[model samples]
Target: MAILSASDRDAAAYPIQSLFVPFPLVCFTLALATDIAFWQSGNVMWQNFSAWLLFAGLVFGALAIVAGLMDLLRPRTRPLRPPFLSSLLYLVILSLALANSLVHAGDGWTAVIPYGLALSAVTFFLCLVAAAVSARKYARLAWRI
Candidate 1:
């Protein structure tokens, strides 16, 4: 009886609510790894992988940003600064890096891969820090609520 009841409760909570951190962390790490591989290998495979990773990162990052904004806009939710300016700056840098990577991928400009990868690494780190800070702030606000 207890086992059955526990299973029922678990089923009700199938989709865990706090999955925010893992998604971004995975995207950031994969993107960085692909970028680094492209930088080191100079292989077409790595270049392709990096491009896909960049696209995935952009999509996931955009979703995360939208979710955060929605949370901020929620009634009675705590006000967060959103780090919009910093995020935007990083996005611009990332976009440029991605563009460079794409352009140079076909032109035999192997050096551009590392440049883009390095920029992506820095941007990912910044994003991680921003997410941590935002999570902490949100936790506090959630506690108060």
Candidate 2:
């Protein structure tokens, strides 16, 4: 058997998009937590943290979308519509996250005190839906084999 080093390996075999899946989940989840904390304590610091988390989530989520697109468009792979749709859903979540982050960019506690929290809540709900759909799609694929 021949062994391939990391650099020598085919990129498609690595599932780069899957590697990125947890980042936005963690970031967005933490953002929600921080928003709650900011509300409870009236601390500006938590609001600031939530904003940064949204920013990071959006950045990583974009990278993940690119990787997912590459995977979806791979030359020989079967046309997997569910996963493709799941990616589209993630893109929507990413867009919402970007908007929510901008909302947080306003000055002081007013930035994230009300509207930001609401937006974040909706974005996080979409994330859960996306994750669930993707899981279902993966399970279907696994069962087919």
Candidate 3:
């Protein structure tokens, strides 16, 4: 009946995937901000920051994906359906992050600024949607428990 009963949390790594999900969201949002700032202020520094943020987001997203996979493979006290869907949603967000990083890899600031910013915005929105879906699923699961 509880949200996460003792048995549901087997160890420190229980729900580890959730811990990493926010990292990319934060980084990608900052990347968008820096991209816009670069476009407005003509600051090369902003472009550099955006590049680093994108890279960080990808790295963190990879970690999250790994954790999610591990969770999926392990036995669980809770139903796996909602978490599986959540993991799929996270995978989509990670794919977008990878694509956004590749876009940044093109020619310098001029090539990526506005377009990359738009991509980041789209990715961020998707992340929000994924989070919402995951939250709703978890809430439904909790009520059933």
* Among all candidates shown, the one with the greatest lDDT: 2
- The models' CA-based lDDT, in order, is 0.56, 0.81, 0.77
Please state every model's RMSD to the true fold in angstroms: 7.0, 4.2, 4.2
Over 19-121, each residue of candidate 3 has an lDDT whose tens digit, in order, gives: 8878998998898888888888877788888888999999998897787777677666235334666667777877887888888776667546667888888
lDDT of 2 by residue, 31-120 (tens): 999998998998999988998999899888888878777767764333343466777788888888888899999988789878989988
What does the lDDT come to for candidate 1?
Answer: 0.56
- RMSD (Cα, Å) of candidate 1? 7.0
Q: After superposition, how far is residue 40 of candidate 1 from its true place, in Å?
A: 2.9
Clashing pairs in 3: none
Off by over 4 Å in 2: 2-14, 76-82
Measured by TM-score, the strongest candidate is 2
Could you tell me how far off, in angstroms, the CA of residue 93 lies in candidate 2 after the best superposition?
A: 0.5
Question: What lDDT tens digits, residue by residue, belong to model 1 across residues 1-145?
Answer: 3455744553343212134434644665676787677677777676676666666666655665566566666533324434465456545644654564455455443544646666667757766666676566567755876
TM-score of 1: 0.57
Better of 1 and 3 by lDDT: 3
